[model samples]
Target: MARRTGLPAVEVLDACESTNDEALRRARAGAPHGAAVAAVRQTLGRGRRGHVWVSPPGGLYLSVVLRPGVARECLRAVPVAAGLGALDACRALGAKAPRLKWPNDIVVLGPDGVRKLGGILVELCLGQRSAGAAGDAAVCGIGVNLTRPRGDGIRPKAVRDGMPAPLPAAYLDECGAPAAAGDYAAAATLFRDAIVRRVDAWAAGLWKDASAAPLAPVLEEYRSSLLGLGGTVLAVTPEGTVVGQGTFLSVDGTGRAVLALAGGGTLSLAPEQASLRPLAR
Candidate 1:
């Protein structure tokens, strides 16, 4: 699609080990920058901490390959930018404006409360160029729900809010649905454009202008849409899980979320896990 539009074409896969994994392989093999890969289904979809992503049919699974020339330190913002991109994509689809949970989950409001809509996973690869010059590449994978889910053992609230009603399988039959192909295409375009724009801005040290704030507004937006702000929850990281009362404070200029813990230490997170549970009320 991108090639036809004079942009790089996104490689489409019917099924794959993982879109992110495939993208990383291609990047390591020296695929051109801006290349993308997408899969209809992922056989080994992974989430943060090796958790399996309940990937099945009727979802959008994709990845983008990036070989950026920016400083390594600045790469931390990629997930945040991708989250915002996903939110923008969903908005173009006419879904209720989706809210981003800190780090990388997209949430939507349902009868119960806010629930997940989609997620992103980023993987970085370290290697050397042809001249043996050290370099790095990253693959960003995304998964979005397009129709009713078919898995069991999912979070009840997440399953309920994330699934869409099934309709006729034909494209012609789906043109009128809320999450139609047109909407998906629009959302994908928005996401791609946002990534390109942000990458350019970050490279130029103008990310604040491109993002429209140093980071406060992004935090405010995320907090306003959070499902369990000011509640007790577990903030999980690769190191370990920290149980705390989370006060959604703000994100720093680099997109790190600042959380105030109940026992007195302030936790700044670019988290890998965020689960909400109600406090004794």
Candidate 2:
């Protein structure tokens, strides 16, 4: 049940548990590269760990199946490249040039302050590789909130002095770019294409040449847009409590967060092991 789109073969669904799930299903069925699933409504959209993604109308929920065939070791770089692609597409479609939070969150400056406009959840599908297949494949799950006139996207962050935490979300429509023209469908299409194109580009980089896969060019762009360099950041581990607090530093080659810890030392933690959040104010 895939439909033809200008960019690739995409399955359009009215509702789904998560587009990522659908992409995984496609991958198992030996879906071709660039095959995608786009859901108008997702009943169980989630991000990063298992944080539920509120898939309201007007948000773009898409998952693209990619067969990069890179060795298991270098697979980590794909998310970084995907984030850069999402940022590029967002800016092009008038998303105020959002910053990419490590691992994968697309954030923008908003009236409420800096907030998450979108997020990415990349998953490796090892089972998809047939016995004679070239390499590993993954699903790049991306979700963007469009035209949110309401409060914030995530829970309010607590400011100093007992004030309630402010909402932590920014919307893309706020960018007001000429191309955006406040069109949701057009933006979705452009973003989907950009992300898939990047996946293809990075897969080659990750597999063909260890030195240049996910090239310097893409890394530089992603680095430039990173949020909270030299600013205080709070790191929360899967254990669900703040594990480390520190000055945000650069992402290491392995895509781990290198932070100058609040106590005293510099620590590099994998994105999966921890969720690093830049403190607002």
Highest TM-score: give the candidate number. 2
Regions of candidate 1 where Cα sits further than 4 Å from its true position: 1-5, 127-134, 151-177, 181-190, 206-234, 237-242, 263-265, 272-281
Q: For model 2, what is the alpha-carbon lDDT of residue 58?
A: 63
lDDT of 1: 0.58
lDDT (Cα, 0-100) at 137 in candidate 1: 65
Off by over 4 Å in 2: 1-7, 128-135, 149-167, 177-185, 211-217
lDDT of 1 by residue, 27-58 (tens): 88887656777777788888666666756666
Give the deviation of candidate 1 from the true structure as CA RMSD.
Answer: 6.4
Poorest 10 consecutive residues by lDDT, candidate 1: 165-174
Worst lDDT run of 10 residues, candidate 2, spans 158-167
How well is each residue in 1-281 modelled by candidate 2, as lDDT tens digits?
12444456466787899999999988878887777888877888887767667776667788888776666666677777778778878877665657877767787766656677778888987753354235467888998777553444432343111112323666566665544425545566676677767766777655556676333436666678888777898877665567788998877666777889878999888877876767877
